[model samples]
Target: MTKMKNESNLKVTFCKRKSGLFKKFSELITLCGAEILLLVFSPTKRVFSYGHPSVDEIVGPLFGYPVRRVEKLMEVEEQHGKKINHDKKVGQDQRWWERSNKEMSYQQLEHLKMSLLNLNAIVTQKMLEFSNP
Candidate 1:
């Protein structure tokens, strides 16, 4: 009925719930011979996904998905990556948390947020003893 207020317990709960949830997904696929794609984003924006057979196989055609735009998108992403690589801080590597929000576009800002989320998830999961997070 209420969100868990304790951070330590909440993180532990997250790991347990994530494990049980993924196990159920696997069971559904195996028992029913189902084709399923699951994408879960936690409260911190960490990404977790499960796809049977494969995500591409189970997902439908994008319905007039722009292949041309995908090429352009890849090119843009490549350039962005190069920019980040070159924009290192004076004494240390530039981290997502260190980047200035004002310089980022809305999409970039979102990507930054997700990166941080993933990083936080990794750190939390690693710091804990359990294998799942």
Candidate 2:
């Protein structure tokens, strides 16, 4: 099993493994002409999903999904576009140091280093507990 030292490391590993899994899933579907629907929930309760052809195509009808009209679909798309734009602007507005560690003061860097080490110890203990149980 892959081990994570801290929350940051865990998150990074999750993203990398998630992307790799999705790529493999895509290859499997393409090579075998298979339908695939995958849903994963992170330890933090966030979701990641991948579906071949379309998510709706595989899971919608079975659940008696509603067929949305063009107007409703368009509205949803507009809202999603707005959300994306807002997130982009927020990211762009963050201070340089907030986005990177290069500008951190010595004290700040030391604090962060200690915090990461503490987190690593906590996570390691939790993993041991889970494994023993």
The digit string of per-residue lDDT tens for model 1 on 1-133 reads 7999998888888877986887798889889999887766676766666667643344324333233533454455557656765665567545543445576556557665554454344434433423343
| Candidate 2 per-residue lDDT over residues 1-133, each given as its tens digit | 6677699989888877877787799889989999997877676865555666755455555554443532354355457545544554354543322334566556445544554344344334433554675
| lDDT score, candidate 1, position 53 | 68
Q: Model 2 residue 31 lDDT?
A: 98
Off by over 4 Å in 2: 2-5, 69-133
- Candidate 2 least-lDDT 10 residues: 91-100
Clashes of 2: 0
Candidate 2 lDDT for residue 71 = 33
Any idea what lDDT model 1 has?
Answer: 0.59
Model 1 clash pairs? none
By TM-score, the best candidate is 2
Q: How far is candidate 2 from the true structure (C-alpha RMSD, Å)?
A: 13.5
- Give the clash count for each candidate: 0, 0
